[model samples]
Target: MNPLEAQLDYAFADTLPDIGHTLDVAPGVRWLRMGLPFALNHINLWLLKDSIDTPDGVQKGWTIIDCGIANEATRSAWENIFATQLEGLPVLRVLVTHCHPDHIGSADWICQRWQAPLWMSTGEYFSARMMSAGLPGADGSAMLPHFEMHGMRDPEIIAKVSQRKSYYPDMVPAVPHAYHRLADGQRLRIGTHEWRVITGFGHAPEHVALYCADLEVLIAGDMVLPRISTNVSVFAIEPESNPVQQYLDSLEKYRNLPINTLVLPSHGKPFRGLHTRIEQLNTHHQDRLAEVVTACATPRSASDIVPIMFPRALDAHQMTFALGEALAHLHKLWFDGVLTRRLDADKIYRFQTHSAY
Candidate 1:
């Protein structure tokens, strides 16, 4: 077999987990994978069998994480599976890694059902509510001026900027009025096992990575993954943010985690060798940054540089996301002093070297 195929086989053999066909991980955790009407296809929900001692024969259940998009099918799956598979175990708590819909969609439903507390980083909790509430301050609306200023003139693109704002509602079964905020260094107990929360920035507001030192297992959420690179797009709320820089800073926090920890990711199969995958992700971005630098020699608009970086092309809907990703990298370079941006006569923004600065 080719080298890439061989490496994948090894990663899966040594690191990939076989949760189930519908579920992407393993069976011990009582995982349930649910479909979402998005390009990414699915999101996973994990139910850790709570081994906590109880007097009433009440089995305790705690969710390892949340699935993003919520719908009748997803909710139905939870009802059918939780009742049968869990044997009526009470959902003790819901732990969310971040504010993304696929990860936090069913949070309110589960929390409300069992009257359990929802736990997430303070930043993500607030952000999730904003997106879930269908408010004007949501990320897409916050991004309008940034795109308008950058020359995204297609009327459909503008309309989609509005439509994309509410994409999370499908997954947001309901919004939680309050949540128990998580922070770095906090310990989360699931029955007898405890997972330490690790915080990171850039990908989302205060993304959490739960690490169980005893079990050598980690619920990585979307902070780190085996296959596709996590989306680190710059949003309208922070128009000039150096998202790439923030994402790189977050990577340093994961480097010291035990390399052999079994990683339970949000999108891909669970695996070990967390550190090796971390290094690969880091290298991939560094290479991309280098390419962006090379492309900026003659000063180009963010839209122009997008095709050069992401040449495969995408659907109209996907293009909006792609443009945002491309802009994020340029913003990072601009803030890092490697590139400088200025508005032209038509208010179109362009970036080039900032040697004078």
Candidate 2:
């Protein structure tokens, strides 16, 4: 077994809820898994049992957290779940931890179905709305130049990128015109448990995680994970951002929390060992930073150093993320004075080790 993985202990690691089915993970809280077509095949959604007041009596309903992507198949799966799992009750509200397409894809569809208001962080809510509305910053063309500037010179890849439309609208068909904004340190009552919003950055602009101190359980959006590393990249939209550092800072904030807390991540199974996982992630990034510094011995563009950082076959879709990540690592080393970036005669920017000076 890998030494890094040994630090974490999982609950129901060998089991997953069947499609359109739900698994109980806590009191009044259930786990629902949804299918996705990407390499990460599934995303976990939470169902919180709550009730509403009516003229006659109390009405029982569920508050759904994180709707799956907006697609025919996903839509069908959700419909099936509602048909079988609801037990005659309707959806009360839709709470989103973030505005990633997979998290907020069916926001409009689900909200309209139950006449529920969408809840999410202001940044995530507005960003999703703007992207869905065909804003200027929400297109492949907008990102193509940034990718190219960071060493993505492959014509075929650039052509594919240029023609590709924003995947957000396709996955996230629409956003609710209005939303209930959640902020860091806000308390929300779902069912009988009070879940506090713990906002973090680097994965998304304003990713929110819900923590129930009494339950000792945390719905860690993408802020922390048990297995795969979270994507912390520099996008064209934020050319000068240092997300790598911001991500680490967010992880540190969780270290002082109870190490025995049950962590329900968006990707992997629920696990224990928050402190161990945070240290593992910190070391992983440090190792990657050292590798980037060594790779900078020769002037190289982000694209040119992609192989050094990630030794894998990347399709056109994966290439986009790889370029962004490579640029992020380069930017980190440059930002830390480990490397210096300069444009060569060909107008291509490359990074070299500070020792080269």
Candidate 3:
């Protein structure tokens, strides 16, 4: 097998073995798999059943864990599934895991249908709104000049910034005018279940993962996926920031969670062993950091170093992201004082050790 495929297989072996096993997660939680043919391929959404009393002795309402993508087909899929499976229950609340398009795309639609209030972490909610509106983030955009000072040039680099400046709009759909802000350690009661909001970062701004201790379940979102590593790329908008470092740091925070707790992730089947996956992800980034350090022994630009890390040919679309992700790692090393930069005679900036710049 090819090295990449083998690495991916080894990383995902345990999770794949029991994927087809039918397991009852809990009385209230139902797992639904949604297909997306994009690079990541799929996303998972959960339906939390809440039994309540009305004029009838008992009725069921639902709290949707995350709204899937906003496309017409995705909406149709959600509609078909809900109609067939949910027995016409109303969605009482729409809880988002993060601001990513795939997760939040249909949020506005779902909220409009059920008149449900949207709930998300305050930072994620505000950032999602800003992203959907095409407004650049302060910290996200602060590092651009640093890239320019490196080998990246004007007009070309400026165009890259302009393109990146619009990424939020490209990915996230516009949310409704109303949403309830959630905070870390906050408790939310829906029907008979009480869900605690656990906020995570580095994957997305203010990512919220829901944990119900009574059920011993965690809606991990993208913060912890079963198969692939979540992309933590540095963008032109966040030129000098080290998203890789941030992502690794964030992974450590989740390592102390209950190891055997069932994790229902956004991209893969529900499973146990959260701490093992967290450790694997942490080690992956640490290895990548080491690779970047080795790559810097000879002065290199972020663009030049991307191929060394990826070691594969990428199309224009892939190239854009590949460059950004490569720069993310380089910036982490640069921030750690392990790397420095110098402007060449041709105006191309190159990076070396701390003494070089």
lDDT against the true structure, each candidate: 0.73, 0.85, 0.71
| CA lDDT for candidate 3 | 0.71
User: Between candidates 1 and 3, which one is better according to lDDT?
Assistant: 1
Model 3, span 187-238: residue lDDT tens: 9886787988888766777888888888777888988776667777765444
Higher TM-score: candidate 1 or 2? Answer: 2
lDDT of 1 by residue, 132-234 (tens): 7767757455566677777677787788776666566656747688888899999877767787989988889899988877777777788877677888887
Alpha-carbon runs more than 4 Å astray in model 1: 1-28, 51-59
* Rank ordering of all candidates by TM-score, starting from the highest: 2, 1, 3
Q: Relative to the unseen true structure, what is the Cα RMSD of model 2?
A: 1.7
RMSD of each: 3.1, 1.7, 4.8
Pick by lDDT: which candidate is best? 2
Show the colliding residue pairs in model 3.
140-237, 151-349
Q: Give the TM-score of each candidate.
A: 0.89, 0.95, 0.82
